[model samples]
Target: MDTSDYNNACFAGISSLFATLLAEESQSEDCLYLNVTTPTYRGSWEKLPVMVWIHGGAWVTGSGGGLYDPKHLVNQGDVVVVTINYRLGVFGFGWHQALNNTEGGTLKGNYAIRDMVQSLEWVRDNITEFGGDRDNVTIFGESAGGWSVCNLLAIPNAAGLFDKAIIQSGGCPAMTEAEAQNVMDGVVTDLQCTGTDAEIRSCLQGASVEDLQLAATGDAPAGVNLNMASVVDGQLLPDHPLEVIESGQHNAAEVILGTNDEEIPAPIFIGVNSSAAYDDILASVFPSPVDRESLRQHYDLWQYGSYSNATAHLQTDLYFRCQSRRLAGALTASQAQDVYLYEFNLPVSTVPTTHGLDLLYLFANPTPLLPLSYDLHRDMLERWTSFARNGRPSGQWWEPTWHPYQTGNHARYRLGNILGMEYPHDDTGCDILDSLPNYRYMGEPNDWFMTRVTPLIGLLDWVLDTIFPSE
Candidate 1:
């Protein structure tokens, strides 16, 4: 991470690519540029399928350039790959509505979200110059990146920017206005800035980025906070993407979505953790005692062998797998075309096939740099770019012919260790979890203003989760 190390590597004839990547990227307010790689075709004007990537860090720390390399995919499929950087943490999701007063409706402070819309607009205007077919653009991302793709599909302004979308391990959930207000209040309090709106804004602008970063993280884990996410601002994003899809108002693009076998560890579910000092963790996720009990009765921790291990399996289903299956149902029921679902169950002896493991395969950017000919490396690139070129993912010799998900009959694909085409039922737990009374609005400020109360937990969750996270 030291610039001097990068300079030394460059001078030693180690690698210009490595040294340049480390040197070029700076975590600044202006880190919103796209990196493009065109297929190595003979003709410079050869039109190719364009795949735009949105990096993920739960809306906190991520950049387009460093983590993923698009060259292999681009060259193999004769496609164009674009990785983008956008605002994160405080700068991205800081919701300052009255920064300059004057009834500030226009200043919705969703600078990070706005950056995406602008980036897509930029692609629409300029991608053709890079030998990419702008008309056939496909937007794909993982985790929070996947979350952004789903929301963008529902956005009115983002209607014609792309024709396809691939969401991996992320379900779109936007914060309601009132919930957003509470989060903003918490941060402003943390900064100890009490004054008129204009004065507070000035103080905030003068504060160091370190101060802002610290202020941004208080109750939530690093890179994950309800506050630092897209909001239902009434102007840009009218409702949650799930609701919009149901009403037949979302983008009608062909969709591909799925989650990892274990999207995250149990600690994230803090509500029912099996780790050290887990008592305090529960309070953060499950605010109500009744809800906690209901959740307690539902699981038998002994079955999974250990608390941490049990919680990991439980959370994988609840947070990730369930939402993915539900999205498949939601999109398909709404008459979406070629909607495919998948579960990555591959074995990683070196590492568990958890959340963002898909990135390790799809992008040939492993730290030690795995050989380009590695089966996983080549197989994934072929599948992703093939999907970008056509709505359906091309099946490899060993893989099954991937099928589109339908309402009742749930058929899909599975990758990695138990890799093959199969009807995945790993998310059957959603049947009960989705219907829970306490688990509404995806919990907390996503719809906290209207449904935070325990009495109407089930109905409110059903309504807001099915509609928009009510304000």
Candidate 2:
């Protein structure tokens, strides 16, 4: 196995810092390594909180090394931060019956998730040597990383690995098992292998890393049915995250979940300029008559009516905001754990409260920022570090009590130039998601439906201001 190293500079000003690598047994033949970071070396073990971070790349493009730099958190919060690299793209997640046969059904799909669980087990056994507390652990991540955190919360085998969790920009309604299989099939075809399960498995095993990556990069045609994601394998993921949450079957851990205000604008704006293109995308994503009717009523499609921008906003709400709300709501309803919900509203000069913008603030790295970003980072760091330390974010002057999101009173922290609290309402968006067919794979444009239904859903939020008037 290959390995890498970082010097004392990795901890710079932090006292007692160490790093190491460990190999863990995996259900899959591949994916058996994990990397660890800690605050010190010790003779006898002392308990320290551990933060196990999972990287995000839509279950595909990211590595544990990409956005993790543990020096700040380790020194400031007095916690151990472990970042593990898992199999990515086709190698990590692709599914085929032949591979299942090879593993004797012990491992079906979701090898990446299994790898993560193994990594946690390794930490539980060995973290004591590195001055970490095996008993206190927090699993956290952003984007697909957050999605992985949600998966862990629901996985039976992953229950005791962590005590708290922070999921940023990913949540329930992520991806289904069938959707993941469709993605795997597309990758297999792109590799030009025979459609048979055995031949496809052989081709994947023989292909180089670069070859697999290239095959995964092409764009989906306009009307193509597509499914790309981490499968809900019964062994690793018993049910959809939402189902698990609703059933109160998730791990008993405190949670912090949030999303950027404008999550999908850039991607949507790039491809959709005309109303026709916007409608095309919407029609494809939300082809259900009931969903379409809900959208019409909720959005007042007559006003602020351009479907293009509306589509972009709708996609953002569906993928980020709505999902975040659902996850938070589920956890709050559990009555067994603490949950916090927030919306990142800090507007960047080039990016408007967009995806990945919160990274700079959360990481607290110096970057060019507008006046608002500067102040927001300071406040955010104070709150976030406070949360990491005591499961409560401390605010200056007045410590804001983060109330759990509930049926009528959804207390969500609105983080922005002016930091405050508010209850979000986008009735149309909620209605569409609630009424849309349950887990239908094809026929009506579900993908486009997400894009079209979101903005109109947001318009319904206008009612929130009137109903619950801000102080």
Q: Which digits, one per residue and each the tens of the lDDT, describe model 1 over residues 1-471? A: 332211111010111222233433544554567778876663356578899999776676667766677777777777888888777766777776545253644767666778888989999999988888989999999987988898898899898999999999888667777767677777788888778887788788887665666566543321124456777877888887778887788888899899887776544443334443233333445577665455555444656655555555656766677777777777887864779888875455455677887777787543444322255566667778888988878857666677788666678777675455776454345765666645523423333221122223334345534553211
Q: Candidate 2, residues 1-471: lDDT per residue as tens digits?
A: 345552111100000110111111212324345567665442235566777878765555445653567655666555678887666545566666667766466878777777889989999999887777788778888887887888788889997888888889876534555666565666677778785667777888897554555455433222111234556667777877667777888887888888988887644444455656555555665666566556656543364455555665677766677778767777888747778888887654455777777777766555664334656766776666566656776677774555665656667887886577787564456546655655321211224335323333334434533553322
Off by over 4 Å in 2: 1-35, 39-46, 173-179, 195-200, 218-226, 270-275, 299-305, 347-351, 368-374, 425-428, 437-471
Task: Identify the leading candidate in terms of lDDT.
Answer: 1
Task: Please give the CA lDDT of all the candidate structures.
Answer: 0.67, 0.63
Consecutive 10-residue window with the lowest summed lDDT within model 2? 11-20
Weakest 10 consecutive residues of candidate 1 by summed lDDT: 5-14
Which portions of model 1 miss their true places by more than 4 Å?
1-24, 42-45, 100-104, 219-226, 266-284, 287-298, 348-351, 365-373, 425-427, 437-440, 443-471
Q: Give lDDT: candidate 1, residue 221.
A: 23
Whole-structure CA lDDT of model 1? 0.67
The prediction achieving the highest TM-score against the true structure is 1
